[model samples]
Target: MDFMPIFCDLKEKLCLVVGGGQIASHKAELLSRAQARLTIVAPTFNHRLLELGKNANVSLVQEAFSEHWLTGCWLVIAATDDPVINQSIYHCATQRQIFCNVVDDPLQTSFITPALIDHSPIIIALSTGGNAPTLSGLLRQEIESHLSTASLDPLSTLATLAGSLRQRVKNYFPAVHIKHQFWLKFFTDKMLINAVEHHDTLAINVHIQRLLTESGAVSLNENRSN
Candidate 1:
């Protein structure tokens, strides 16, 4: 039951999805969003899937999946409703040691797809170990509301500020405890909330300035202690 958790970089990587139904299409859409170069294999495609292929950056192989189809793919998803077809895909992927997720069939999968909420640089994934996908999905939706658009802006601005501060005050390393404490407060402070809530660039900028001043103080104290 032990499994390794890792995120795959699918951008420009070969990915295969063996189905054209709604579940198959859903998996394909997620892969496409990750910039994966996808090839979908199915005897037929739904109307929406066909339209999506026409404009989307993907390939369509219209035929039943053969054992050879698993060749050269970085990851594969067996989302077809047919258990027989899914079993074939699982065995093929297992033989090749390629990661594969078979929807609703945990025992046959090498990986599990979690419910994800993506806000560009910020991604939250929820997993129920393939027990209740619907519940996980609902939980993800609930968690999404708490992460406001503004919550991310301060973090982005903080990154830029941190880079400049690092260069401005070079050749000094604060004590690990002090450094950790300073950043913990900086990131989790009310200033971030205010910056996000008001959407005021000025407020966010001020928050960054305060954080820089605090870091400077900590650095000066550390030097004095030494």
Candidate 2:
């Protein structure tokens, strides 16, 4: 992969958007969803952005872009139509060691935003290293459709349960390979699968406890034999 995939924690972090157009607005909205504090600079903003500015987390500045705006920003997006302004923003951000994305111009961007499927606690991201965004977006849509119709528990709910069970599993199976084997069996267990498909929390818990008990007994017997 040309670019490494990673998720950023932008909660309460300062982010700068240097434009007032739809693309800029979209980027700002994504940041706001991550709870980032935003400072948007543009001489004139479209209606959508103006509405977004009403949010307490967003601060809109009606002015031209300036290097001074980069101060304390964890990330910056250059969405202005003017190539000169975008280049300037990129250079300034580079100088300050800040991550910068110049809209659709990947050549000028230090980072590229991927198309995301946010199923909270189970987010999925797709990217083409900024080479083929349309293809990436199409694939994301198809995967999202499949996920919605799949005969499985909600991904977020499943992930949450797995997270809650992690410590218990670790405690039960101290060896890495044993823990891995236990999870593999647990997920594929017919009883657990049926419980998950029906969203039966009580059944799921009981199934887990029964499996743990059986596995623990087997481990103890193996140790006695050894």
Candidate 3:
């Protein structure tokens, strides 16, 4: 892969945007959603950007782009209309060892933002290495549609429940292989599937407990044999 895909936890991290237009606003909004402390620097800004600046986590600097703005920033987006300014921002960020994205100029960017599908605890990101954003968006739509029409419960709900039961599963299984086996069976079990489909948390918990009990007994027997 040309670009390694990874999700970042930007909660309270500093991020800088070097424009106040629509594209810059969009990038700022995404960072804000990630709970980043966002600072936008621009001589002029559009209405959307002005509105986003009202948020507690976002700050707007009505001044020309400068290298000083990049100080302590974990990520930077160069969204200025001027190519020279954007290039300068990218170079400055590079010197600071920060990941910088030059909007619409992937070749100059250290990172490219992917189209995201947020299902809360289950986010899916689609990217084309910044080669074809439109195609990436289309693929994302198709996947979202498929997920919505899937026979099973919403993946987010299933993921949330799985997270809540993770500690319990670990405590019950102890052995890594045994824990993996329990999850594999839990996901594929007909009883669990039926309960998830109907949103019956009680039934789901009961099924999980039964599976844990069975697996624990097997594990105990295996240990005794060993």
Candidate 4:
């Protein structure tokens, strides 16, 4: 089956996982990182899951899985070693129109989770549509080695300012082509890279001003004010 990839915002959303072993613990940890309101259902939990629950502050049910548990979940995972129970969980979640992923059973799952490189506000997910998860994990580690906090955080901050900068451009330049050109040059200019590399907001602003000056589309009113 073909799967189109998407990144979900699980913050404050309910997520239910049916299992408590290592695999389930791993999935729960990832969901917790996204700040999901997580519930783990199993007769017992692995030591790691207990630790994760304490840290992520998630709900733990020391009982068998039940259909009622599917009631309000925005997302579901069935990672149990019991095939019958996992299948049942998948059916219940699917019947409820909720997305569910069954561990090691891609055909039974509605979605597949990918190995991710999260430089939050800039996440890169690698997947082979459940065909090659091992390879994806290897690539994720390889990519992680190349990324640093200093490099990613500054660009993420700059990305936050992009919306306001776009609005300013729209208000200042009425010509569509010139506005597009200005942004193109702004990105290509070495100073924009320097500003981002150095985390220099002031330098970024100066580049924006440079865009207006070089675009040659500044209004006559602005020229008169000058």
Q: For residue 133, what is the lDDT in candidate 3?
A: 95
Tens digits of per-residue lDDT for model 4, 100-214: 9999988899999999887766789998888889999999999888888877776676566665688887887787876777777766677776887776878988976876787
lDDT for each candidate structure: 0.80, 0.88, 0.89, 0.86
TM-score, ranked from best to worst: 3, 2, 4, 1
Q: What tens digits encode model 2's per-residue C-alpha lDDT throughout 10-112?
A: 9999999999999999999999999999999999999989999999999999999989999999999999999999999999999999999998888889999
What is the number of backbone collisions in each predicted candidate, taken in the order shown? 0, 0, 0, 0
Best by TM-score: 3
For candidate 3, lDDT tens digit of each residue in 130-211? 9999999999999878877454244556678789989988888789999988888877788888888888989988997899
**Angstrom error at residue 24, model 3:** 1.2
Q: How far is 160's C-alpha from truth in model 4 (Å)?
A: 3.1
What RMSD, rounded to one decimal, does every model reach? 3.5, 2.3, 2.1, 4.1
TM-score of 3: 0.89
Inter-residue clash pairs, candidate 3: none
> Which 10 consecutive positions of candidate 1 have the poorest summed lDDT?
165-174
lDDT for model 4, on a 0 to 1 scale?
0.86
TM-scores across all candidates? 0.80, 0.87, 0.89, 0.81
Worst-scoring 10-residue span by lDDT in model 2: 149-158
